[model samples]
Target: MKSLAITVWGMMALPGCRPGEDGEGIALVRSLPLSDQQKLCLEKMVDTFLPDTDTLGAVQLNIHRFLDKLIANCYPEEEQKSFINGLDILEGKAQDLFSKSFGSLENLQRESVLLGLDNEENAEEKAFFDFSKEQVILAYTSSEYFLTNFTNYEMIPGGYDGCVDVPEVPFKV
Candidate 1:
């Protein structure tokens, strides 16, 4: 558990640690600097899941930093920017509709916003939001919290364990 928490913090702190596009091993891409509005959006996003200090400290994950790596590694440069921009747009709409940003909304409220975005007759916005959410998920999973905390990394000895105790069977004729 402590290790998981450490990994989460490491992920969050990662954005500033690596530098320049030439860095190696999923470490080269620079994080897009957040605008004031985007910062507010991020705050809302963080708040959406991080209400209590215990929970926040428990995970200690830097979701944004994880996102930075995901976009860098998985997306083309042009598409990545556009996809991220779409997050800003979604957040803006969320703020307009609910008087709170997307990240700040309650889970149900966030889902409702997503539902509206999905149901839109406009094809472009739907595509954009879908991609954005997909990116968010990718970012989340790549975070150290997920890599270290949520998964079992221990080496297992080679053999399956099905039955703990078995009765000896008589030889069949």
Candidate 2:
């Protein structure tokens, strides 16, 4: 379990390591530059990328909050602006398409919007989506739920079985 503990510590110590920032209890998203509408839109975007499965979804894993912390703390100022601007573009696209905010769309509508964005040749939109998708995947896979339930990971592997029954040698001189 030492290795597991180390891995957990390593994850926690990533760029913006702050003590007691469990990505669960702290309302760090509020401290981010994003407004409430933007935050909600981000949450919806995360849900679109990682919806509910048998396992915990992005929302359940609190990946949105994790992403907010990562962006607000870990990422550079330019990257932060890019991400927020990308979000604004996404929301604008949603509005242009459905006449509603992205957060208010149904699941299929959200998926459609994302699909459209993914297909578009716009460099900025593509970069934003790619960046967001990468972060979401990283956050989800490194989450406690993924480690404990999906991987069933152990710090130390089980003991090796070395003993084997020797076959009797017939007519051994």
Candidate 3:
């Protein structure tokens, strides 16, 4: 199952795997079945999950876009519904804690709210958050930008050293 997931993810990460053929600067959430507000909220959530550093972020690397495509194209309908509903719950939690939308909250406040949710005992909410977080991380790490730029991953590994002599050991049998 893990291998299957990795294979699927690899396929999705291929060039030209985008859901649509728009030029650069295209918003990936536009192709998803979510509303504008939900898209904003999800983008903000993704940004928080993988924020900007001295180098790059989820937003800059378009991990949110990758996630949008992955969820829309890969996830089953029930899972999609659960994720959407989870977004609603996340936004509600933000409002309850900060009296504002999740996208509008200060960074520290947003972190606090998310931390509270992470520690909560709600099974469904936790599942949704965990699933979304996992997908986001997977998509980002497997992305070409990260693989090629942030990591030492090479398409081909160094040549094998096949000339080494085998060491012999005494057998108890």
Candidate 4:
């Protein structure tokens, strides 16, 4: 199963599944029949991880969809099932710790939770948490926000002197 999963993932990684194309942004999940819990958890995950940058956030990039595809097509059955089930564990813990649910945790609270997950001493949970977080970052950065806002390339160019001294203006006209 692991081998099969790996093979499938390799295929998916072959550039055809580029993170953003057409209109298949992060909105794909919204069109699907996700459970209420899954929806909430995804929303929480997005809100928690996304920063107000010029680049695309995870939600805009449809990372949840990518993740779904990865899990269904690439992850070993056990790992995929474990993650499907374990999402609740993360969500429940976030709610218990923050008292506002994972979706509702304030920025500081979410940060604390994410940091705690990252710092776990448990080998298994730590590995899974780190994997999940890495995916989250990937999804967010590849999103349209990052693609559009983080970069600027002008087709036209003008030559400017590499070294020039500006005259100081004495008055603030």
Task: List residue ranges in candidate 4 displaced over 4 A.
Answer: 1-34, 140-173
What is the lDDT ranking, best to worst?
A: 2, 3, 4, 1
Cα lDDT for residue 25, candidate 3: 50
- Residue 160 accuracy (lDDT) in model 3: 88
Sort by TM-score, best first.
2, 3, 4, 1
- For each candidate, the alpha-carbon lDDT, in order, equals 0.64, 0.88, 0.82, 0.67
The ten-residue window of minimal lDDT in model 1 covers 50-59
Query: TM-score of the candidate numbered 3?
Result: 0.71
Better of 1 and 3 by TM-score: 3
Best by lDDT: 2
Considering every candidate listed, which one attains the maximal TM-score?
2
Q: After superposition, how far is residue 1 of candidate 1 from its true place, in Å?
A: 47
Q: State residue 105's C-alpha deviation in candidate 4, in Å.
A: 1.8
Clashes by residue pair, model 4? 26-62, 55-145, 55-146, 56-145, 56-146
Off by over 4 Å in 1: 1-28, 42-59, 72-74, 103-107, 147-150, 155-173
The lowest-lDDT stretch of 10 consecutive residues in candidate 3 is: 22-31
Q: Positional deviation of 45 in candidate 2, in angstroms?
A: 0.5
TM-score versus the correct structure, for each prediction: 0.52, 0.72, 0.71, 0.57
For the record, the alpha-carbon RMSD of candidate 3 to the native fold, in angstroms, is 9.4
- lDDT tens string, model 1, 1-173? 99999999999988767664887445355565566666556544433433335334212466655565556666688977776676677787787889986766776786667677778877767987576566555655566655666676435647898978888999999
Of 1 and 2, the candidate ahead on TM-score is: 2
